[model samples]
Target: MLLSLRGVSKSFGAVHALQDVDLDVLAGKVTALVGDNGAGKSTLVKTVAGTWQPTSGEIFWKDQRTSIRTPRDADALGIATVYQDLALCDNLDIVQNMFLGHERLRFRLLDENAMERAARGTLAELSVTTVRSVRQLVASLSGGQRQSVAVARAVMRDAQLVIMDEPTAALGVSQTAQVLALIRTLADRGIGVLLISHNLNDVFSVADRIAVLYLGRLVHSGDVAGYTPQRVVEIITTGTLATAAT
Candidate 1:
């Protein structure tokens, strides 16, 4: 496993957002995390992304137990999260946004050429060819194009594990397909992806594994081959298979 969580739990006062969750993500594979609203999906992603430390749990990276107490820590461990909002700077161009904080420098000056080359190369490698140019402003790009830029930036940063939250939300059918293809490209290049989404069609399209959460607990997790859309719906609704749902 590239990343693993054991006996993980999180709490806010009397509310338990996650309870004894165990999950694993492998390099070069996509793991889809599915659940209904308020099923602790956001809580789990936030905890893993370093937005919040777990109340009690163990996180292992490549089998070594460690604590991610800050976003920097997560970055140092090669973990990058692209939240639903994407956190892109609309005013900046694709290259600028990609190298926003980590801009290249030469002789006490910004290395625009270097950054542009790197950004363009990363996008090309990921097969994001819809953009006219890396110099184009992010605001002018379509929804799926913006998503492609966000993912390209993460790849340029050498992210080993990318956790995406609702990546295909609110996208048109064609745009959604584009983003889903990009996700598959990530896994093909040996990057681990943890995709949090409510869309079953999208999940079934690219995920090699699936983990289902319900009411702060992980109800089911395994290879995608073992689950059907119906079984997943039942688990999300009643925390069990339909045959077992009472």
Candidate 2:
């Protein structure tokens, strides 16, 4: 397992965001987290990304327990999160966006050539071919192309685990397919992927494992092949397995 959460919980004053939640993300596989609104999915992601500290429980990276108290701590551990916003500057070009905060320096100055070369190399490694050039502005790219850039940026930072939130939420059919294929490619490259999506079709298409969260607790988690879409919906809505209810 690349990442594991055991008995993790988080609270905000009077409200409990997560309670005794357990989850695992394996290298070279996609683990899809599915749930309705207020199901604690966001809370769990925030906790893992170091945006919020867990109230109780342990986080294990590579089977060794560790603490992730801040986003820097998570990044140092090779955990990168791409939120729904993508966080890319519209005015900046691809190379600038990729190395926004971690620009390479040459003689006390930003190395534009080196940065561009590295960005192109990383995109090539990920087999991203939509954007015409690395110098293209982010606003000019399509929805899927923008997603590819965001993911490539994460990979360039040496992220071993990439957590993506609603990566295809606003994309059309073709764009959604493109992003989903990109996700599979990422897993094939041995990077653990945690995908949070509300789309069941997307989940079934890419997830090796599906975990359903209800309210603030995990209700079901199993291989994707073990449950049908209807069964998954039942689990998400009622917090019970179909067989158990039957």
Candidate 3:
């Protein structure tokens, strides 16, 4: 496994956000984390991304025990997270936005040419061709183009594990399809992906495994091929798979 969360738990003041959540992401596989509102999906993702440390339990990377106490720590360890907002600077061009904080320098001078070349190469590797130029401002790109930029940026940093939150949310049919294809490309390249989404159709389309959380606890986890939509809906609402028998 590239990433694993074992018996992880977290709480915020009076509310318990996660309880003994166990999840695994293997190379070349897309794992979907799904749940209703307040079902601890965000909490779990944050814990793994190092936004919040788990109050209990452990996180393992490549089967070695590790502590991700900071976002920088997670990034250094090859864990990249793309949140709903994508955290892109609209004013910056594609290459600049990709290497925003981790710019490559040659003798104290920013290597703009190197960065631009790398950005273009990465996008090409992902088969992203919608953007006419890497010099184009982010504000001018379409929704799918922006998402591809974010994903390409993450992969460019040698990300072994990528966590995406609502990647296709609020996207049009064509835009969503584009992002979904990029996701598959990521998995095909042997990168572990943890996808958080509410759309079961999208999940079924790309995920190899599905993990459901209910009221801060993981209730069901299995291969997508083994569970029906109705059974998954039941697990999300009731924290049980009893409906699978029917």
Candidate 4:
């Protein structure tokens, strides 16, 4: 496994956001995390992304116990999160946005040419060629192109585990397909991916495994091949797998 959450739990004041959640994400596989609103999906992803520290339990990376205190710590460990917002600066170009905080430097000077070249190479690796040029402003690119840029930025950082929240939430048919293909490509390249999405159609099409969270707890987890859409839906609504087994 590339990453594992063992007995992970978190609380905010008197409310529990997560309760004893156990999840494993393997390298080169897409693990889909599905849950309704307030099912602790976002909390779990936040914990994994180092946005919030777990109140209890442990996180392991490559079988070694690890504690991710901040987002930078997670990034250092090769874990990158692309939330629903995508965090791209619309005013900046692809290369500039990609290397925003971590710009390349040479002899105490910012290396714009080197950064652009690296950004181009990363995008090519993901087979993303729809953009006219990396110099174009992010605000002008299509939705799929913007998403592609965000993903390329993560890849450029040598991310081993990429966590995406609602990647296709508001995209058009073709754009959604494009983003989904990029996700599959990431898994094919030996990257562990945790995808949080409500669209079961997209989930079933791309995920290798499914983990369902309900009321702050992980109620069910298994291979996607063993569960049907109706069964998974039952589990999601009732927080039980008994109906799914039938």
lDDT of each: 0.94, 0.95, 0.93, 0.94
Give each model a TM-score.
0.98, 0.98, 0.97, 0.98
Q: What is the C-alpha RMSD of each candidate to the true structure, in Å?
A: 1.5, 1.2, 1.1, 1.0
Clashes of 2: 0
Specify the highest-lDDT model's number: 2
Inter-residue clash pairs, candidate 3: none
Q: Give me the displacement of residue 147 in model 1, in angstroms.
A: 0.6
lDDT of 1 at 33: 97
Candidate 1: stretches off by over 4 Å? 244-246
Question: What digit string (tens of lDDT, one per residue) describes model 1 on residues 1-246?
Answer: 999999999999999999999999999999999999999999998888888999998999999999999899999999999989999999999999999899999998999999999999999999999998889999999999999999998999999999999999979999999999999999999999999999999999899999999999998999998888888988999998758532
What stretches of model 4 exceed 4 Å from their correct place? 244-246
Tell how far residue 142 is off in model 4, in angstroms.
Answer: 1.2
As a whole number from 0 to 100, the lDDT of residue 212 in candidate 2 is 93
**Backbone clashes counted, model 4:** 0
The candidate 1 region of ten consecutive residues with least summed lDDT is 237-246
TM-score between model 4 and native: 0.98
